[model samples]
Target: MTDSIRHLSIHIDRTRDDVYAFASNPENLPAWALGLGGSIVREGDEWVASDAPMGRVTVAFVPPNDLGVLDHDVTLPDGEVFNNPLRVITDGTGSLVVFTLRRPAGATDAEFERDAEMVTADLARLKELLESA
Candidate 1:
């Protein structure tokens, strides 16, 4: 019973490649994704963050590419998996980074909105970081 898919996008005055490269790196998660704000270490084929919610978690990102497909799956310590869909598209002036956020089952409306706001802020942070660089 997940809620609607919420899309939060931010326009950055940077090339699509640059934005995608920076945003897609798991090591750079803390610089933008507030929820996983910590130094991530490689665990075999995945990235693991020990200090994240539910203790340690594993993040497996889609292989980097030029097409701007930035999808990843986060595995919680309790074995729940959250799939995140993200993308970067080039426009005339710059790039558009879009993140798809979904409300987990049983989340209240307020909680869902709060999650959207957090993701919106995170995307804005990523835009600022990239545009400033």
Candidate 2:
């Protein structure tokens, strides 16, 4: 079974266009993405990240207000490669961002949960930055 976790109904004080612009641009990723290592860019229709743990990431989807998804194969400090999927959705008021990490099939669940928590906090930080600006 593919387990999925959802974080819905976050509210931020910003316009839809402002939020969309911030999230859609690859340049702004490091600004709000807490542990992100380096810069991001667009290669054709996909967003790509270089110098990050992932080495290079590909954007899976980008939509107006309904959805956006990014994926990467990240190399850990211990030399483990993790497949990371990030999803975002506008929730009328703010946005709901979900990050799903797929490790080796036999990997423990605890670490994945921890990673999800970290991403959730990062999203909260993003909300603060956008709303405050």
Candidate 3:
């Protein structure tokens, strides 16, 4: 069975449009999503993260829309795919970014916690980058 879902969020002191514009761009993943390492490039229509922690991976995001959905699918080199649900919603004059992290099947408690920590750190990085800009 798969592990339970966990929702993590970070408040960015910026407009939703600004946040969404930055986060939705695949090229910007490396700047904030550290899990993708420090660089990502487009190969055909898909974004490729060649230095990802789990080796090279392909990320396919949803088409740009006004709904603030930033969902994407990451396919590992081993052919495993993970669907990631993410969004940037209005929060007063700023924005709130939420990421839904689901632990992979058969992951240990410690591993799940570690994944959460990594996501928290990534969101923190996003907040820092956007807020300071």
Candidate 4:
């Protein structure tokens, strides 16, 4: 079970398919994911992001599909895996992008809030980029 989970979402002024197609692509990770954007390097079938505060980590995202699932698993240098549950749901004429942020054990309130803020920023960036495209 997770220590705690925060569900953060942002409404994107775009089709669910379009938002999912763009966000679900690993090649586009750095475009919105703040920290990994400049250092996520692809190696064969895997991805490695260098210069992470915790050292280099591997990232693997589920393939994009019609159901709008954008879940991904990131492997820390310590070999711990963090699962991120993300989805794009249709709402009226636009789409809502929801991201689940699981609080790690022993994480302070500040840490958790910072993470939530980061995800919020990332999603906002996604919304802005898509809406203006």
Per-residue lDDT tens digits for candidate 2, residues 85-120, read 655556676566555644455546786577666677
TM-score, per-candidate, Cα-based? 0.93, 0.61, 0.96, 0.91
Local accuracy by lDDT, each model:
0.87, 0.60, 0.94, 0.86
lDDT for 114 in candidate 3 is 96
Task: Give me the displacement of residue 31 in model 3, in angstroms.
Answer: 0.7
- What's the C-alpha lDDT at position 119 in model 1? 90
Give the local distance difference test score of model 3: 0.94
Q: After superposition, how far is residue 78 of candidate 4 from its true place, in Å?
A: 1.4
Count of backbone clashes for each model?
0, 0, 0, 1
Q: Candidate 4 on 1-133: residue-level lDDT in tens? A: 5548988999988989889888877777777887564668888888888766678888888875789998889898889999999999997899999999999889998999999998899888888889999
Q: Which structure among the candidates has the greatest TM-score?
A: 3
Instruction: Please give the range of 10 consecutive residues that has the lowest summed lDDT in model 2.
Output: 58-67
lDDT score, candidate 4: 0.86
Worst lDDT run of 10 residues, candidate 4, spans 30-39
User: What is the Cα-based TM-score of model 2?
Assistant: 0.61
> Where does candidate 2 stray beyond 4 Å?
1-4, 63-104
Q: Give the number of the best model, judged by lDDT.
A: 3
Q: What lDDT score is found at residue 23 in candidate 1?
A: 85
